[model samples]
Target chain A: MSQLFQHLEPSDSHFEPDKDEVLNAIRWNADGLIPAIAQQYDSGEVLMMAWMNREALEKTLQSHRVCYWSRSRSTLWRKGESSGQVQKLKAMNLDCDGDTLLLQVDQEGPACHTGRRSCFYVRLEQNKAWVDQAPLIDPKTLYTNKP
Target chain B: MSQLFQHLEPSDSHFEPDKDEVLNAIRWNADGLIPAIAQQYDSGEVLMMAWMNREALEKTLQSHRVCYWSRSRSTLWRKGESSGQVQKLKAMNLDCDGDTLLLQVDQEGPACHTGRRSCFYVRLEQNKAWVDQAPLIDPKTLYTNKP
Candidate 1:
């Protein structure tokens, strides 16, 4: 794996993501994307999971905000930009395979578009039935003009 | 969003994932895969994140073992089967958009192949340096024999 390692070049962003040693350790998929999971910094509750391309990762490291690559939209999405549910990055970690990232974030507002505190609002019941573990706030309340 | 809800037919799964109502809500990617994050049941530490196809998710819910779809090998991976780092599913959750899964597990041994308790061992320091938050245990010590 070390043989495949390549370093990130310096970026103009305020944070020096290029200087971050493990940046080169990320093993991106053929699509040049990796899964990024966000967990609440204090509670350890997982807020949401999204995909990040190399640029998205770099921007996140520089901005200290969660940035995701919107596959459907093919654009860089700064979380909470439209919904006001911003996630401030507290820390980031790379999994063993270097294909996954765990981001500890200071979450503001609900992390779900459905108005849930965390995106994981449904659970499988013992009877194999799925039930809501949390209540949904009106989506309209989260999005100002709908992004 | 609840108005758009529907139910699933009964299945033989102990938890009745078919009865698990949110099955249809999941919006799997074009590849028919979703990212699943595993967290320690007691400590709240995120262990690792992996990809799970429909079959992998079904089997995991049925058998109570964490099963992942290995993109590299294109096979179903039963965690810790060879290394004895098995993850017993304690609870499972689906994100609001149904694109991701959160699993709470009772993990045995290290959850990372690198012989670390959690896969998130690397952290970015203030000076943009990557630091090891945990010590790595020799991989050979974890595996009885190469699987």
Candidate 2:
């Protein structure tokens, strides 16, 4: 049996996602969203967690730049749109149930809005949420508007 | 200036998270839920992503067994309760924004219900979701009940 689990169509080397397959592949939540996690391609370090809609997934797949849905703002959030910290999508994976997404990304800059390399800076150690890393750049410089 | 971000109370050597901090620290969504990602402590492989409520968080912190809120069943899901694959919590991190959670776990067995090592077996390569890893055990044997 071929190792290929689910193939859209024969593409010699390039990714050519079928539009219908893309939409039907995932099991979207009640709100038509799925939880997406960004992991560093080289380091395997999880950079951040966010939500994505079908449109965001399509945009990311097409442009190869990660985009997410800003639930609070009720709009599409292009990663690093204002801060220039764009993440280049290396690979994407869907969990078995298809309720989650894992994106291997080549992050341009710090992933956290707080200027940390990863958003997971608050380590639960010794009963305290210790700030594990210091800011790489001033957070003020990262965001243009209050997000 | 102290590097300590947010401290619950003093626990010299062990993690003693404050109950108040546990509940108040997180910015729960309108539905009072947060997205949680589980990663293997040693490999840094993201095993799975799930939802967590205040009660789930409290249970995980207190018991260190890693429980999730089952949105589908509308009940608490104890990791490996049905299957023998319990995850031991090594560490927990709250992102700077406190909206998401990262769980470093010592997974006892396959993290996926499909009996695969990780839920993220459906890799998007060449525009198709190829099953990178095969199931170590039969999935039918893993699930005792319809979940």
Local distance difference test scores for all models: 0.73, 0.77
Per residue, candidate 1 scores C-alpha lDDT tens digits across B97-141 of: 567889999998778776667777556533564435443466667
Q: What DockQ number belongs to candidate 2?
A: 0.29
lDDT of 1 by residue, A40-101 (tens): 99998888888999888888888898899988789999998898888999888776556788
| Candidate 1 docking classification | acceptable
Measured with DockQ on alpha carbons, how good is candidate 1? Answer: 0.37
lDDT value, residue B64 of candidate 2:
93
Highest-DockQ candidate: 1
TM-score of chain B of 2: 0.81
Q: lDDT of model 1 at residue A77?
A: 95
lDDT string, candidate 2, A1-147, tens digits: 111223422222234444356457677877899889999999989999999998898888888999999988989999988888889999888776677899999998799776768887667643455555667777778888423
Backbone clashes under 3 angstroms, per model? 8, 1
- Cα error, residue A1 of model 2, in Å, equals 26
- Looking at model 1, residue A106 earns an lDDT score of 97
